[model samples]
Target chain A: MLPYGLVTIEDRVARLLTELPPNPQFPTQGATLFVDLARRQVRQAYTPRRIIETFLAGRGANMFYLYRLLDESLDPIDPSVPLIFGSGVLTGIVPSAARGNATSWSPESGVLMDSNAGDYFPSFLKMNGIDHLVIYGRADAWTVLWLGDGQVEFRDATPYLGLDNIDMRDRIATDLGGTWTRDLAMANITRAGENQVLTSAIMAGPKACYARGGPGAKMGSLKMKAIVVQGQTHDFETAQPYKQYNKEIATKLLNTSVVKNALRTMGTPFLYRPSRVLGAMGTKNNQETTWTDRLDAENITPYRPGMAGCFRCPVNCRPLNQLNDDQADRYGRGDGPEYVTLGKFGPNVGIDQVEPVIRLNNICNDLGLDTASTGSAIAWAMELYQRGIVSKSDTGGLELTWGDAELVERLLFAMSHREGFGNVLADSTRAIERGHYPTEARKYCMAVKGLMQSDPHDARILKAFALGLAVSTRGMDHLRNRVTLEINARINDDPGFKAKLYGGPVSAQPNNYETKERAVRVCENIYGVGDAVGMCRFTTKLFNSPSLPGLEEFSSQIANVTGLEFDADVLDRIGLNIMGVERLINHRLGVRRSDDTLPDRWFDEEITVGAYKTEKIDRQEFDAMLSRFYAISGLSDEGVPAEAWRQELELVLSGPA
Target chain B: MSITVRLPTTLQTSGQDSLTITEPVENIAELVRVLRRQLPGFPAQWDDSMLNFSVNDEVVLHRAEERVLASGDVVEIILALSGGTPVPRSAC
Candidate 1:
């Protein structure tokens, strides 16, 4: 039974839902959906006049966009319990919108975790008249939740249970709605999630995924199949501010020569060759960082069908990779095999072939598993096998050898089904746990705070990236700020810009440990702001160092979209607040200075590649750098936020659950 | 002292990691001209607009001919491996 006496705000188009305080302690605004089997309701009660103060702009985007700011009120959102989803103020409207967080308490790390994915659902959701959906309690049986024209419906989903993503998509479309004719999207769960696999992702679409923590399993536990969002791209005249704002990015992406050609032509797979040259890829689970010969555009091109884009995005960086007979025999074709997939499965796992790598990628999508974690885990297992720590007996009678694609496929299948050895690889944190390994295997695991490392860019080569990987709030993610100033130090900026932005040298060489702390601090702040505002880092030149969307333009985008006053300074403060608040959340979750360090491999082992040879995070220097960053972040010596800073961000206060 | 000029993956000569100029070259222009006569397809994969030269590790933004190179200097034709070719940062 749904909670009775639920204050309803059925504006229909712009619904604001709130959970009734079981204890009347925590006052939550930004739409938190609470669902039960019997009925679905939107509760926008407890409208304190002071709640308007909480409204940064229109319930901080009608209690949608700036929802993550409501994190303090909505802490301990058990990912094992409620399957929650929320959007940003300008999610569906902006052309560069690639983010909207799926906030939940991680079953893997037992911390607050949010997984971000791009396109489709976020945009059309607005037109259909829904901000966000938060599911509470369990459904009686297998169910499908559909949202259309401001109405929520639940149908029997017993028939579609245990189906793969591709087949599931077609079946879901037929059952829930019609074809992909409308701009409809859903967060689809899989068998991996149903079985409580920690690494399972809620499939965002066929290609992309809201992957990180086990959101799928959370949905599966609820006996829910998919949250079908039926919405359309609204007309231009209805919201002139939105139209003008969308045009700002759409026009730039269409006309600008800055980001054209490369992404469109080769997509992200083009990075393979250069990364090989620099010897910067994490090859064979970081035992080696470079590949002598690996798949690049030349080999991967033969499989490319065309370009793939997110909802209304023109700078589509995904290649629709098709499979041949032998390749198709193992697994059918899919949209990506993105750079992350390529890196994780290709060089990282020791497979140089593009076809099998692509197939492995498809299998990840189909099974609704995170390719980054799954592939990295497989690579880690392969290394263990080589060391004789893992044998055929433990591997379920298959050899865990490097560059073995067939074995990779078999292992992924097992992982999805949570069968045999796959169960061990499912939870990264468990593997990191002492004595969880067959032998002394915890040291070999390349993860930060239980979450798997992203992008596979060897941190040994890029120092700032290493810092970010060490200290990222969520986990080891590159999107926190794709630190490329080190890569393009000379080509990008001046002493003025550098000093103004990061208070560092203009030609801040990638090798120099100096000035990196400042650089990383600035990058994280901006990226946090981008994440908060639901801005896509790729399309907009946010942290790509001196690129597009300068301060004035950034603020104008916010003001234009929401009719709120924002600028570079305000954005900086917002980012700082988010980071500070995130610190408090982690503080509550037991993450401290001790957890804010890199893997042993990064500190002990030198990068055995030319140009970056004899490079590793010097422990003494890194320790001091972390201290400097803490000071800059207004945190105490122990990486805890100052009491004053927490109060300023309203994090010191709390509400009841 | 003679120097070797190296190229990235896109511009490197087949089966060669670098091109060594034992003959004396005065500047970048002289090096480019000599390389054109010396190597096949020297300018085929290059565009004047796209090529940003790095003498040693420092970026050479303008007047490549004026930026003289003596012996033991490594000249690298800078181009992004993926896509970001070095566009000039406006003279400050």
Candidate 2:
């Protein structure tokens, strides 16, 4: 009785077939998949050209789609909450364009949110001729959605239940295709998601994940376990222009020494050396700001298996590591121990040893827990214990001590399973702030708007970074609005260049408060565009490298790949519009000017050690900066988008629900 | 003035992370000059503009020549790249 003509071999399984109408503008020709698991209904329809044109792809598309799906009546944790998957238009066709986005209402933040990942999943999604996938409604039983050969299959995921992400992917691939399935990609969750932990991540490919904003919890709420994709590859190399363009980009990436020597050779651990010396990282749960080099990248080189990249990426910045040490050997091999992981599990918890950090990262990856949040949660508890706020009696007879790697690992598992004291950690900082010691412990928890400020870097001195983190829609995320160039002394000293870039004199000094709002605004715009297009920030100009691609390159690539005439200004506007849309969604969720603020510790506590010792956010300066940012972002003094912004965003949101 | 000069792994050639510059250097520019003279393997192409000189954890962001250094100062010379280790910016 399905409208699209369902075919059923068994009463439990259902399939819907539909024809795609050709649209010259869309590369996918408006291919969209809609699945309602509660009703066991599936439908395929042409995505409106207006939606594609206005939103573009990836997060840009998600912003509009998520906004439309979200209503005042819809609870953030409702089982019917829409989970969206989208890819950039240029994905699979261009280098460094393989990143994908998953959008849903964050159960933790109580707001619409999206997290991105880089891997074969996005490429396979695009190659399989599906540009956008939307799944909603709770299934009667655990289900896995298989996308391949221009069709979708609903497979019972009961057998895959309770399996880790890696196991689930391997088993699903073997069951659906084979051991050597070609071009098969999988995104799955683990025990953490099954337990509905707020910090769970959707593991894409082997290591990449849409980790932020708790997208895995949304997937779990729908009784979904994994999504498997197998698609035919497109040979754009046959086209001479496309081939030459890809070569040009690949050559540029290789030519950049940062990419070749530092990023590719050492991966994200390359930042460890700088962060250690510069005192950029938060140590011991923001109580300290410096750590020794025991956890340096050079120490990790021995265990690194090899470098891996997403789809057509040339940078290959991820190191697929194999732990060699006796303690870490049991966790087995996995990707990452990214810089954030190094800081979060290492210095943040006072664990200087490299192996323990790797073990912690691997455990999080295996259990589908976010290392940032997990580390933060444990660090918060340790600090609470240190301050004598909590004791062994309250912790189920477990002493929360700093540098206790064994306890950290055990707590990660406990948090995943919501066991004992780990249940408190799994509920996020807000729950603890309100439920536990509201006054004494709240000051110690470094969270903004319920989401833990995951970046291990202390932002007290990094004024632009602090401002960016404060105003980020998803709450306290670095990638959204970090003006990395603020720390580059060479760039900062060049007044003319700075003025041209930011439209004003933005200081290069990390502690300077003047003109930072301008820099933050510009960075917000660039990141908006970057996220929309699914470009990894590391591969873009945002990463303090002039050689990497930015708006100009993206504009040209979009033209070459999609035949769309989206100039840099248009892209900038689209990014800006996406920001406005996100703010509007949050506004509807009761977010106000008060919500656009940082943690109390950022302003109250001074960094004990570092080059920027005694540095903290000046309340007046931060307030002024926030006001300026709002003014420039076309928002009212109260943090609401002005009428002009509303009209412009409404124009984009006006087309086809 | 005996100053401690710490070099990043990428810049080190003497198989050491740090060296003692016993020579008197008034500012970061002079310190760089002394470094180039003392360390034979120091890249001659590097200039004050290319490096971030942090004196006792305080970064000399503008006009390194004007920022005065004192005896017993710990000078950490890192690359201008904010997110990564020291590398020649010209290669980009």
Candidate 3:
């Protein structure tokens, strides 16, 4: 059944060593916990040699390995498509590395998807000695899987089925007789996830979520209500260099970086004013690029009475909003109203008020829905209604009008329950549009590979940002390769800094396409490393701050903490290897060079109302940029991985052709 | 006769929400010079990397000197924070 010289799965397993290569001893490395609900079996296994490169690296690498191991034998919606949670190698050991990854076959994106989230869940997971937890097969009933103190328990979760994320957390606390914030941490879904809504997310804590790619839908499909981790903090012996570097990073983050000042005070809403001023704000489903000042940072600051941060993070960037009685009725209070949430819910939908936007954000979060997808989906429908493609009759006599926050809130509840018209929107924009006006609605869908566009930046003006969104592994996302530094207006003239950062003489002009491939490639590598190490990109060079921790610092930290001798170059290679695996995975799923493209709207529609009017992506220039990107990424013009890349990554093609 | 210049909280002078430029200004550079003179703690020289200017809600991406300002124009002066991209989650 296998081709000549092809390595089988069995062969790869046989070659795996039980222990890591002898290195400086550290407690970061741990066993993979495999839970099989179908057989009611739980087992612990060491990282296999085949995936050790990614396994040792963690997060993004872990996500890549999961996608690589996606069972071609099963359908995308199959419950056997294991939902895997991976802790970063440096997670819990270093500051800003307080994140974890949740990867599964996306029922929405129709591809393998990984969503990263902050909070102490990942740290708790690592504390409980789990590097990666893989849940396999569907449970016979709603169940909660509890792991802590080297014990695994499967408890009945039927009573908690219809609860929102906040209520579920409370119930879990009451049932377990432990405070969720103090001793226990959890990942839970809400009614949206329970109903297998394609846009659902998994709430990681009260404040954060793994909010993309429908990992929540996968969990719901598996009949998993929650996974709780009870952890005891373990102190690791660290070298002097590690301690010194850690202190230096904290000092720079707290006292040095000017960017952190606004972030600390206003959280992500600080970017809102700048986004509007830059003409990047996507208002009214991206038909316009500006909105009312009611959603401005200064205006929104009143509701944000406090701020919070992930474990060990210095910059407390999460805004804790004070909810009114009406807004708190269902969703309850959680941290939010971030830039994206405000952008998507406010300007993108033509609603300008800050409080109402925060209300929508709360409802979406409580329902375990991806705020990006939720807002984008509703925006698309509103646009459809504007175009007269969708009627009030189709919307169950409710007018899908712009700025109708009340109607949007009602639809969100209906979507969670899959009621009437809301059932149609529960899927992606592409699917919803296809089911209605397939031919006419296709262009207005604003989706790339079934995932709705998340970033509220109007892509017509920013060429590299547009390209990044087009080629993202998880379609239409900003987090993957967004060169956030492009927002620095001063960079426009700083060719030297651009040259040094991108490793080429790239233009810093947002609209320029020449030499942009280099910048994109560098960003991809940096983000790759950031995700792999379980560190937030905001604290890394990927964010606008140039002096933030980069590959070299990550390398030093990893060496000092784990004794793994990964130099900066090796870390970059790991990033590239992850890219290579993603390419292969997408290739297997029928993605080609043709699919690596922006929507026609981006190429055709110009920003009509700005000083930078007539700003649109040049198709020919974008194609050339794509070619350069492919060449640099070791891919053919067709976007397929080259033999050299495969050999370099030690990847052998042995599956069905 | 005057341009209403809005300032972010970080760059506000004497906790004022906005400042009025009484001096005649040709462009953002001239406006910045007036602000440096009028407002205490304002940098002596215009740092293009540190501050961003928008005339009538339109971003003057580069060469702020070229963006001609008119009387009664709303020239928003804000700290040059990072660009308009959000982090992975809605929150950081």
* TM-score leader: 3
Off by over 4 Å in 1: A1-32, A37-81, A236-245, A254-258, A325-330, A432-439, A492-494, A500-507, A542-545, A651-657, B1-92
DockQ of each: 0.16, 0.32, 0.28
Residue pairs that clash (backbone atoms under 3 angstroms), model 3: A487-B83
Write the residue-wise lDDT of candidate 1 on A1-657 in tens digits. 111222221221133333222221111123334456434443333222222223221112222222322233232323223445655455655676645667666666566566777767655554454444556546777887877775677878889888878888888777656546255787788888777677788887886777876666666666777778776656422212556656776766654332454466666676555566566788888888777444776577778888877766667877887786555363666788877899999999888888788888888988999888888788888888888887888767878888888888888888888887887777655664634466478678787877778777788866777888888877777777556555543332335545655645533466656667777777777776665555666655534324444445656765665455566776666666666666666676678897888878888998876566778889988888788778888988767678787665552222223
* Interface Cα root-mean-square deviation for all models: 6.6, 4.9, 7.5
Candidate 2 C-alpha error for residue A141, in Å = 0.6
Better of 1 and 2 by TM-score: 2
Q: What is the lDDT of residue A583 in candidate 1?
A: 67
Per-residue lDDT of candidate 3, residues A16-95 (tens digit): 22232322234456667667776667766655433545435466546544543455556666865678898877787788
Per-residue lDDT tens digits of candidate 2, residues A1-657? 211232221111122121223443444433556787787777666555566666677787777666655544566667655788887777777788787788877887776567888888877887787777878888899998888786788889999999987677768767876432247788888988888888889998666888887878889989999888876567542212466777877787666656765678788786766666666678888888888778878899888989888877888898877876465464867788898888899999999898888878888888898777778878988999998898887789998888989999889989999899888888766555447554678888887877887678888878988999899988878888888767666566667766776768887576888888888888788777877677887877656565577788888877666667788888877777778888887887778898889988889988766567788998999999899899988998778679877876776565422
What is the docking quality class of candidate 2? acceptable
Model 2 interface DockQ: 0.32
Worst 10 residues of 1 chain A by lDDT: A1-10
Docking class of 1: incorrect
